[model samples]
Target: MESGVKKLKKGEREFAITAGVFFVGLIIFLLAGWTVLPRLSYAEKVQPVEFRHAFHGEDVGITCDTCHFFYKDGSWAGIPKMEICVDCHVYLLGQSPEEKKFVHEYVLKNRHVKWGLYFRQPECVSFSHSSHVRMAKVACETCHGPQGLSKKPTEYRTNRITKYSFVVYGAEAPSNNYGGLKKEKSVWGTIRMDECADCHRSRGKSTACFLCHK
Candidate 1:
C-alpha cells in the first residue's frame, strides 16, 4: 500500500509538470497571436509594374529626389511619371520576365501603368515633402523605410479597418520590434497624427489641428 501511494504521487507530479508546461506554451501562443494576427487583416495588392528600387537606388545610385522632386512653390512631385521609367526602359534592357512584362504591357502599349501609392494620405491632410526633405533635411528612409535597398517590387497592403496602407504604420513593423532591432513600438514608428504629435512634442512644435489639417 505504501509503494502504491508513492507511485500514484509520482504520477500526479508528472501530470502536474506536463500541465504546467502546456499552459506556459499556451500563454506564449496567445501572446504571439495577439501581436501578429491583427496584421493578417491587410488586403494585399500587388503592383502592376515590378520595379526594383535597389536596382535604381543602390546599383545605379539614383537618389530619391531624382524622381521625387519638389517644385519651387512647395508642391510635391511624389511619384515619377512613365516618362522617367521610359528613359531607361525604352527598350527591353534585360531578358528577365519582369522586363518583358513591363515592355509588353506598358512600354509597347504606351499605356501608363497605374502604380499603387503605398503611403497615400487623405485629401484633407496636408503633408509637405519639401518641409520634411529639403528644409528639415529628413532622410527619405525615415518615412519611407529602406526602399532604397529593396530588390522586389512594393507589396501594397491596406488595412481593412483603417483603409490606409500598411506602410503608413512603419513598413518594417512587428518584426523590427520583436527582433530587438527597434526599441520603439509600431504606434510610435507610424507616420500618423500621433507620430507627428510625438515629433512635435520632442521638437517643441505646435500640434494644432490647423497645422496638419487643411
Candidate 2:
C-alpha cells in the first residue's frame, strides 16, 4: 500500500512540473506575439509630403470634397492630381517648410506628389467610393476617421508579407475592457472584411461574394 502511494505522489509531481512548463511557455508566446511580432511584420513608411489637413480645412477653408471628388460620370477620383494642386498651390500660401518643398520640388518641376495611400485595397476587391459616398450618403469620415481635421500625418504602417497598410487588416481598436482585436467606432475605424460584413448587415445590404470580390 505504501509503494502504491509513493507511485501516485511521483505521478502527481510529474504532472505539476509539466503544467508549470506549459504555463511559462504560453506566457512567453503571448508576450512575443504582442510586442516582438508586430515590429518584425510591419515596416513604417513616410509620405513624400507631410500635408496638414487641419491647416487646409480650418485655416484655408478647403473642404474634403474639394480635393477628393467624384467625376461627372460618377467615377471616383481617388486622389487629387497635380492639376488640382497647381490651381491653389501655384505659390506658397503658408510659411510651412513643407509648403516651400511642395512649391519648389513638385509644383515647379511639374511632378505629382506621390502620396502614400492608406485605403489601397487588393486588385481582387472592387470598392466603389461613388456608390458609398453619393448613393448611400456615407460620410468620408466613416471609414477614414477625422483625417480631414488632423493636424499631423498618420503613422503609415504596412505589412511586409501582404504589402498592404495595417489599417486594411484592422489594427487594435480602442476598448474599455481587455479583449482581442475588434471593430473601432473611434478615430481610426477598422476596415477589415468582418467589419465590412457587420456594416452591410446593419444596413440590410447583401454580402454576396461577387458584390465585393472580382
Candidate 3:
C-alpha cells in the first residue's frame, strides 16, 4: 500500500510539472500576440462585400492576369486604367447590371473606382511587378486576393495614416494603429504597413528599408 501511494504522488508531481510548463508557454504566446500581431487601424467596411476565390479559380477557371495589370519590372501595377474594364465590359453592356455599371458609370467617364488597395507598399518601396509576374511566373493572386470571388463594385477604405510594422524592433505597440485616412472623405479600412511586413514574412522574404526603400 505504501508503494502504491508513492507511485500516485509521483504521477501527480509529473502532471503538475507538465501543467506548469503548458501555462508558461501559453503566457508567452499571448505576450507575443500582443506584441507581434497588428491591430486594426480604424477599419470600417462600407458595404459587406465578400468574394469566394475558390469558385472563380477552381470552378470557373478565370485567369488572374485577365483583370490585373502587371509591369515588365518587379513592380506592381497598383491600379489599371479604365480601358481594361472597357475591354471586357464593352461586350457585357446589356447582359447584366453588374457589367453595365463598370462600363457606364466608371469606364465611360475614364474614372477609376477608388478600390481600397489591400496590398500596398509605402511610397518609399520600389518593388517591380513585371519581373515577378513575367519572369518569376508568379500569379496575380500570390500578392493580391482574387477579386472574381469578391462582390462587384468592391468598396475601398484605407487608413488616413501608415501603421508602424512589428519589426520596428523593441517598439512599444506590437502594431501601430493608423488612426484613419480621410484622404477622400470616405470610409476607413485597416490595411496597414504591418500587413505588408506580415505578408512578406510569410513568404520568408523581408523587404527592409535598405532593400525596398529607394
Candidate 4:
C-alpha cells in the first residue's frame, strides 16, 4: 500500500511539472505574438519625397485644408497634385537639401512625386472626409493623429497579407473623448471596423451594414 501511495505521489509530481512548463510556454507565446509577429507581418517603404508637415503648418502658417481640400462638387481632393506644390515650390524656396531634391528631381522635371499613402483604406470601404470634417466638424488630427505637426514624414508600413497600410491600426490618434464620446483604450490606437462601429454607436449614429461597406 505504501508503494502504491508513492507511485500516486510521483504521478502528481510529474503532472505539476508539466502544467508549470505549459503555463510558462503559453506566456512566452503570447508575448511573442503581441510584439514580434506584427513586425514580421509588415514591410516598410520609404516616401519618394521627404515632406515636413511641421514646417508647412507651423512655420509657413499653412492649414490642413489648404493642401487637402474638397472640390466645388463636394468630392474630396484627397492628396494635392504636383501643381499645388508648384505654387510655393516652383523655385527652391529654402536651401534645404530636401527642397533641392524636390525642385530638381520632381518640380523642374515635371514628374509627380509618388508619395506613399499610409491611410489607404480597402476598396470596399467608402470614407467621406467631407461628411466627417465639414458636417460633423471632426478635426483631421482626430483620425490622422498629430500628423500636421510632424517634423518628418511617417514611414509607411504595409501588411504583406492584406496589402493594406498598418498605420491605421498602430499609429497613435486622438482619444475618443474628442467628439463627446467616452474614452476607450481600444479606440485610441486603432481605426479598425469594430472601432469605427464603436465610434458610431457612441455618437448615436447608424451602424448599418451599408454605411461603410460598398
Better of 3 and 4 by TM-score: 4
List, residue by residue over 1-214, the lDDT tens digit for candidate 1. Answer: 7656455567899998999999999999887777666556666677887778777887778777788887889998888988988888899888779989998889889999898777777788898788777777778766676666556565656667776664322343332122211243232123567667887788777788887899
lDDT of each: 0.70, 0.73, 0.50, 0.72
Model 4, 8-72: lDDT tens digits are: 46789999899999999999998888777867877767678878787898998998777888998
Tell me the TM-score of each prediction against the true structure: 0.72, 0.79, 0.47, 0.76
* Candidate with the greatest lDDT versus the true structure: 2
Candidate 1 vs 4: which has more TM-score: 4
Give the C-alpha miss distance for residue 190 in model 3, angstroms: 8.0
Write the residue-wise lDDT of candidate 3 on 1-214 in tens digits: 6656455467899998999999999999887666544244423343222223344456657665665555564455565555765675555435455446656666676776665445566677666667556755666544443344342334443443553221111121122333223232222223345555776687777567665567
Off by over 4 Å in 2: 1-21, 167-190
Say which prediction, candidate 1 or candidate 2, comes out ahead on TM-score. 2
Instruction: Let me know the TM-score candidate 3 reaches against the reference structure.
Output: 0.47
In model 2, the clashing pairs are: none
TM-score ranking, best first: 2, 4, 1, 3
TM-score for candidate 2, please give it: 0.79
Of candidate 1, the 10-residue stretch with the lowest lDDT total is 173-182
lDDT of 3 at 187: 24
Each model's number of backbone clashes? 0, 0, 14, 0
| After superposition, candidate 3 runs with Cα above 4 Å error | 1-61, 91-95, 130-142, 145-148, 151-157, 163-208
